[model samples]
Target: MKYDLIATSAMGLESIVAKEVRELGYECEVENSRITFKGDELAIARSNMWLRTADRVKIKAGEFKAYTFDELFEKTKAIPWEQFLPENAEFPVSGKSQKSKLFSVSDCQAIVKKAIVERLRSHYKKTSWFEENGPLFKVEVSLVKDVATLTIDTSGSGLHKRGYRVDQGEAPLKETLAAALVMLTNWTPERPFSDPFCGSGTIAIEAALIGQNIAPGFNREFVSESWDWIPSSVWDQARAEAEDLAKYDQPLDIVGSDIDHRMVKISEENAFEAGLGDLVSFKQMRVQDFNPKKDYGVIVSNPPYGERLGDRKAVEQMYKEMGKVLVPFDTWSVYIMTSNENFEKLYGKPATKKRKLFNGFIRTDYYQYWGKRPPRDNR
Candidate 1:
């Protein structure tokens, strides 16, 4: 059935997420921090498999302005819980309230949970004791200026857990960030791409997948696969679609390098695990040693931003070395994701494009540099 679905994304990644939704042939209405769309079960499955920038996909159950506890109890109970939840399923609710008639979040959570449980008890005649063994029930309650909105999370775990990167070094980029960096570039399998500071090989692997058009969820299983309502045939169909998109014989020139030999080894292992060893290459080399190939491509990296690796001075030197190595590739476009405010000074130029982003709790920025100016005619 068509339902209101909201895909939550990182602060600055909302536009990218909206683009992904639109590419999937869905009409999305963009909001402040999320995108709202209406789709069926297949849409849910597709989002879980393909959305690289979204944090969670939530299904709207119901919404209303509850000026009092009594109104909240009645409105929440009216939501059709049985259609999505089994008679024997156990569910819970959690909420957050601000500037609303109901200001206490804890109280709101307890009330919503009680209302849902009561509705299920009467519908199923489940007067006896019951245990909650079904898939996790994530409830979101947002009260802004006295209006309350509730949604159920279809994805138990965030989509970033692609299950391939079991091993990671210090300050590794999130899988979502890696995927975003790939999407932000113009790299294709016909050309070459490189990451000089490829920690754990996230960017290289993401690029390989992008080149092959393989679904990001190919290496992992999502929590939605366990829901009783979604049939196995649907999942099989999605898997088939993903497999059909995979081009095992596709040509690609992707390389990852790191000064630390151990990180290089980790990257190799990850590529081997993801079955991308043939498409991507990993090496233990410093930034100065990397020589550009003939075909034009992209260089995207999440370099260490003076955190844990060394002091501020050493980090600046490292970025300088990175710039020294990257500046020689006249045909390549370089993108750096960092939390350092002085990265522009280190890199020696104001970015052609700068976007504000967040890496977990750290406020970050994505800096893009064009190695060569475009022709006057093109401009």
Candidate 2:
């Protein structure tokens, strides 16, 4: 049976995530917050395996208006818990409320949990024998404008936990956000890509994986495996497809560097774990120390915004340093995602284009600086 699938993405990366879904041969109803599509269990598995920028994959069980606790309990009770969850599993309800009829979110959460527990107890024919403590089964309840919608979390620990970054440096870029930056570059495998302020080497690693067309889930395990109802053959099929899609022969120039030597070491280890050490290079150098060997390539970076690093003066100096390093590459293009517009003054020019992007709670601007390149004259 087809089920409604919701792929959760970061606030600014939603459009790119939706595009990635369409690329995978699925028609999605895209919105500002999330994208909805209809797929079976295999589709759900595929999404969990390949989606790079999504936060989680959810299976829509039921959605209805809940004006009171009784309505919430009754609607949640109707869900067939035995179909997806094992008897030994714990189904914990998690949710949010905003300008809704059920103003008390805690009360709503309790009611929903009670309903699921009631269903599970009835299904197993044991009032108190079923274990309430197992791997968590997440439930999402959204109370928006006084209407309630609910769904089941099929992807646990979020997709950002790519299972490679065991440690992080100061203000390291998130793997999902780094992947989104790589996507915004429109870079093919033919072009060079580099990140200078590559703390923990997230952008560099993500770019290398994309260039080689590696599945992000290759090194990771997923929560979908916990569902006893899905056949083992289906998961095997999905994994086989993932294995076949791995690419090792592509030549790519993906590189990352940081001022910290330890960060460079961490990046190398991460690449090794991802089986991409040979495809990516990590160096210990500051932005000023970098001099490109190639003329035209893509430079995508998330430099320190000075939030936890330093004061405003140091941030301005950092931007100035970036400007100096980039001034000579007329054919090259650069994209900087930061929360500061003072970057314009420091760079001594206005960006050709700016897009609104959010990095968690900090609203950011994605500034595209097109280096001076004379228009080609077609004779």
Candidate 3:
């Protein structure tokens, strides 16, 4: 059966997630942090198993405007929760409100919970209390401008937890964000890719996944897998398709390095866990020492942006050194994400293009320095 699905993303990556959804053959409506689309049970399974940059995939249960507690309860109860939530389903209500009459999030959550429970109680015919011993259906009630949108989480954990990267360095980029950075670049599998400040090797591993056409969620599980409404055969089919689509034999030319030896080791471990250890090379080296032997490579890094005073001076020095090392590679493109406002001045050259992105909650800019294409002979 077709369902309204919403793929949630980071604030700046909605378009990317929408593109991914479209690639999956679904037309999507992109909003601020979420992309809503029409899809069937298989589409939900496919999205949960393939979307690399989305945070979570949720089923849009219902939407309405409610100004008062009674209105909220009645409107929420009007939704056909029985179709989605089983009699014993453990559905917890999460809530968010903005610019709405019902501004108390806790009250909103409690009201929604009561409404759903009431609906379930009526549907099941005799329910003093639900067992809640079955699969989880995490419900979210979000209010914006007095409009409430209810959704059920299909992905139990965030998609960023790809079950890889058992360990990570300090301030490691989220897997979803790292995947977005790689997708934003023009790097192809044929071109060399490097991340000089690769913390726990997120970018490199994501690139390897991209290059090899490996589904990011292939090795993980989603909450919907346990939902009886979506037959297990649907998930089995999605996984089989993912396995068929992956190019395990594809050769990848990706490298990641970090100044800390321990981080480098962690990067290797993460890559190994992601099943791309042989495809990505990790090294213990500073950004200044990075010198790619291959011409016409791509450098995408999330370098250190000193939030502390003591580290600011050293980070600025490192930025300057990065300019010294990378500027001379006229044929290699460079993309760096950092929060420093004066990154361009310190790097000694203005970016060819810049895009605003958020690395977590901290606002940052993706400095893109486009390079001349390699000679035709190289191609």
Query: What is the lDDT of every predicted structure here?
Result: 0.82, 0.82, 0.93
Worst 10 residues of 2 by lDDT: 370-379
Q: Where does model 3 exceed 4 Å of error?
A: 376-379
Please write out the lDDT profile of model 3 over residues 200-244, one tens digit for every residue.
999999999999999999999999999999999999999999999
Model 2 alpha-carbon miss at residue 378, Å: 13
For candidate 2, lDDT tens digit of each residue in 1-379?
7888999887878899899889778899877678889888888888888899888889888788888889989988998866767778877788899988898888888888788878878988876766656666788788887678788898888888888886788676778888988888656677788888888888888998888888787677777777766676777777888888877788999888888899899888888877788888999888987788975677888887876545777878989988887867766778889988687778766877888888878889888876544345121
Residue range 288-379, candidate 1, lDDT tens digits: 78787563667888877786555778888988877777776777788898889989888777888988888887898899886553344242
Descending-TM-score candidate ranking? 3, 2, 1
Q: How many clashes in each structure?
A: 0, 0, 0
**lDDT winner among the candidates?**
3
| lDDT at position 201, candidate 3 | 93
Taking every candidate in turn, the Cα RMSD to the unseen true structure, in Å, is 2.4, 2.5, 1.4
TM-score: which is higher, 1 or 2?
2
How does model 2 score by TM-score? 0.94
Candidate 2 residue pairs in clash (backbone atoms < 3 Å) = none
